[model samples]
Target: MSPSDQVLGTSVEAGGATGGDWVLHPDRALPAEPGVRALAREILSAVSDLPIVSMHGHVPVEWFVENGSFGNPAELLVVPDHYLVRMLVSQGATPAELGVPTRTGSGVTAEADPREIWRRFCAGWHLFRGTPTRFWMETELVDIFGVTQRPSAETADAIYDRIQAVVDSPDFRPRALLDTFGIEVVSTTDPAWSDLAQHHRLAAEGLGDRVLPTFRPDAVLTLTSPTWIADVARLGEAAGVDTGSYAGYLEALRLQRERFKAAGARATDHGLATTDTTPLSDAEATRLYADALAGRVTPEGSTAFAGHMMFQMAAMAAEDHLVMQIHPGVLRDHDPAIAAAYGPDKGYDIPLAIEFAHGLRPLLNAFGHHPGFRAIAFTIDEDTYSRELAPLAGVYPGLKLGAPWWFLDAPDAMRRYREAVTETAGFFNTTGFVDDTRAFCSIPARHDLARRIDAGYLARLVTEHRLDLDEAVDTATYLAYRGPLEAYAELAS
Candidate 1:
């Protein structure tokens, strides 16, 4: 049996805090004031166990396809998490010390011992204080795995062995854990060229509704990427359309979208440094495509082409009925050396100050009212919450504000999110709490944190007489479940 199959007694009950556990407080993220805390507890209890509706995430599809057991605690929790790695790196812990694999030709070899890596992580637990990474890891260890002892230099081995026992059980396999966690539907991010055979296989096995793919065309859409030409060719091959011409390229993308839709894709995700969505004339776009293929497209021309394609993508969503997800304003891989050593997304991407008002005006103006179109705008730039995104989402029929994303998906940031956007966009105009995580085991913890934060926010509303207890509980349920269902309703159709 895989380690995850050993079902002990229920370890996740409220108010189960013991001397052994790190954080099992019933009112973990609730308001501190007595009356507010009581009210928040009642509100949180209403939605605490709602089936998770994970509409956007990066959990690997192969985990479901293979139904494989996770290898070890470190592989499951440590190596893959940039949130943990980045923190340790900041505190003088080398990536090699934590077992973060270096890219080939980077001249650095990561540590191979899981126990040694876990020991380092446990010893450095103090570094995670006041961070969401600690919260999630604590919950994963204590609640999910039934770990009781605190992780420290002395207790690391004991904790590791206890977790290893459960992880070796059949119950710990990825598919079993889905039911164990009560996840209703989870989406995996897939590139545009993907065949989605694994998704299809899941459908054949009668699990299609539980796992879905999200179409992501960023590689093929970014005209300036070094691999752009090769990515475009792959897209053409996948779609069975020649992408040698601009018209053919657009057709290929549309065909790929159709394939993705057939494979149960409900949404398309884009990552951009800016949300500029200006269009180019057909002739101009055609000329740019030819120049790009011929290796003559200038840097200036590439930027214009990227913006033009964003407009085109919106147009495609309007026609194809895929919910659009755009997260802008991150300078990806801020440290070139780290990026070179660790291929991208090793948590070096830094947030930039961005203006959504003017940058997104063109796209919103064009497709904001399209009957078949819906877009969710996510930002790491907190400045834009009330200043730009909330106001835009408040007025636009086709747009909704996404949950606090990446660096902002934390306890205090979550409270700040509600405080900033609730007055403008209101609760229903936001997309609810999406974990947006690659760490599969942390999904429940992430969602739990968001719910606790929301419950506190709603309790405040009740105290202020803006809402009654019943209304607050109802909204809590909506934010946890129905809101995501509504935001990505295309998933059902």
Candidate 2:
């Protein structure tokens, strides 16, 4: 018998949900109190099986186009996930020991073996307790892979072998799994200069209508980035527009945005260190662009240029009807040494305090009331949720509060977000949940968790007599399915 069969004393079929030894409680994330839990259960039953509308995430488009077999368990589950890598690294495990390749893609390290990495992850599985990562991991293993035994040093090999067998099956490929998971729509972030060959291929294969791209022009907007010049040149080449002057650069960005829209992109995403959006005069912007191109731009000049570019992007979004998404307040690469060795997204990005009221005034004032513009603002600074973002989104027809993201995507944080923002922004002023994950297998788990949390929050409203049960169920349905569809309507196939 195989290890899984030996462990379970029978062959565990994939997606059987027959792992009595490792079952997820039906009301795992519902309220603990019996009365509240009952209400939560009622609320959850209404929307539990609603089709998933994943508006924003980082899953590669090529995964669906290729439909290739996933490798061993560790490579699929642990290696590519920066969240797992960062946590293990914090607990004295090296990235190399977690099957993470070096910058040069070389695997000549101590943890090059997939089985060894799986063992290491199992050994440290306790580190994920009470974390969202743990919740998703459990769901993926037990519900998807049909593992009867919990992951630990004792059962590492058995679980790994079982997971590997499941992953290698035809049922585990991306397109089939997307259908299995009931994902109605998903978006992948792409750079402005991208040729979108993968997106084209997926479209040609008829899967492209469900998987869409999001335009992310951060590198082109940030004048101080090391690749800014090269990115600008590439943008010019791709758009067939000269970027030698500020006017030409703006035109190039406009062309790229049009191309992305033609390729089924509904939104443009921006990540800023701050929320500043001060616009510049044509003359000043032109001068700064010239200085930046000549490599003589100062720090202050770069910040001004970035802020102006944000305003410009807003104007372009207003014209093109693409939903604008701004994610700010992150100080990326908190530790330069680790960044130098491991490259970007090793999970060292830290949040900084941000004030959105004054910082975003210029952009909001210019487009907040525009008939065609819509914007969603996301921040790691929870203080801004009620104090700044909610109040702004409450009044501005153009602005909507993005769901709690990054460090604040946990259960408690999400509950707090509902309490803080719902009073002012109300239900419709928010964009519902955005998984924003890179882990493909965790997509369904993440969405399920969000739905449960929303149900619980709505149950409290029903108990408080603030909303009737029918209204609560309708609201839950909108949050789970309709909200994202309406918010990103332009991307709909």
Candidate 3:
């Protein structure tokens, strides 16, 4: 028997192979009914070739700047992927076993061998059954890397060898892969204190506006963090301003945003456990800032300060024309032990219930009608779709509901999102879709899944006599391509 046959545990056959070899059905995520499936196929075909406008994501800028080969399959696909690492950890796999890097002086040694990590992941592949992770991984394996065999203990070594060869090829370089993936513009989330050296390097190479940076100021804004003082200092140095006073700190943040905008940034991202945007009087703000700088800030002070900063961020967005992207209600590092051992993003962050109507009213009241200001709000809380978020987006001219994201970026959840928001908020009041991934290779797969789910939803709408076939195709095209472009129109400027 051939090695491929032995590894896949099946004999090769004509037309299509069976048994252990991985096969992605052409109708994978579509509606199962014949009539709806046919309509979905037509709708999907119309917009499937649109270039991906990944306006919000976590792919590192260094990947594009360096233009080097991926180290190995495990590093590219396993270690940095929280979606995969979280599932493996839940199924009795250790982060160290999966080669997740630990913090400095954490004394926890990660498994150093890439092959061993790959073996551990392959053995636990069943844990991802019926998950979005599995769907994305399968697409990456079969479509991107041309792997025909299923991942299992028996096939792990063979699959890894094949993937390693592909990673070593010059075509696998990050810049080359952008063309392969059809990404028109991809944004990297950068800290408030970033000097944007990597971004300048890429821009100087004439890759202007293709790769953009996003302003993320969570560390400097959170007064309760242990490193907040140092982070404030870094922000001051990066912005060439003093941060010793509250007024100076605000100016520093404004200057940083201006720097990001000059470097091709179109948005600022804020992640919080709550959605509070209450503004404070200048006196109160100065007092909190002084307390924070003196290391005497209370828990109440921190919460108040963060909410005030949210209000300030929105005001800044209005003046600067940078679209604001807010994704809140996530309690980071639920497991303290894992966080201490393996730092953050090992998938311990869990979602909490958030109230958007009351928490965001102050900010909306201040600038929701301003033509220059625009905000996209995302939530894992499905309950808010039709209740709070949809109604708010329906009325507020400056606000648009973000697509299903993070934990809610699955097939059923994506369909549910449309059902909940399309009534009140409608299609134009929403941003099409944001991949929001650090897993660079999975961007196309994630976008494809969203497109298929949306087509299926639009197909059902057509069959229900709500929308005509032509209208469905138009809406599908808008959701896939035009929505992002319109929402982030400043990018074109």
Candidate that would win on TM-score:
1
Off by over 4 Å in 1: 1-23, 491-493
The residue-by-residue lDDT of candidate 2 on 400-435, one tens digit each, is 988889888888899999999999989999988888
Q: Residue 168 in model 1: shift from native, Å?
A: 0.5
The lDDT of each candidate is: 0.88, 0.86, 0.90
- The full ranking of all candidates by TM-score, starting with the best, is 1, 3, 2
Winner of 1 and 2 under lDDT: 1
Model 2 clashing residue pairs (backbone): none
List, residue by residue over 1-493, the lDDT tens digit for candidate 3: 2223333345544322344456678788999999999999999999888999999999999999989978998999999999999999888889998999998888899999999999888888888988999999988877676666888998899889977877877667899888888999999999999999999989999876899999999999899999999999999999999999999999999999999999999999999778999999999999999999999989888999999999999999999999999999999999999999998888998989989999999999999998889999999999999999999999999999999979999999999999999999999999898888999999999999999999999999999999999999999988988999888888322
Residue 174 in model 2: lDDT? 83
Candidate 1 — what's its lDDT? Answer: 0.88
TM-score of each: 0.97, 0.95, 0.96
How do the residues 377-410 of candidate 1 rate in per-residue lDDT, one tens digit apiece?
9999999999998999999999999999999999
Model 2: lDDT to the true structure: 0.86
Question: Which candidate do you rate higher for TM-score, 2 or 3?
Answer: 3
TM-score (C-alpha) between model 1 and the true structure: 0.97
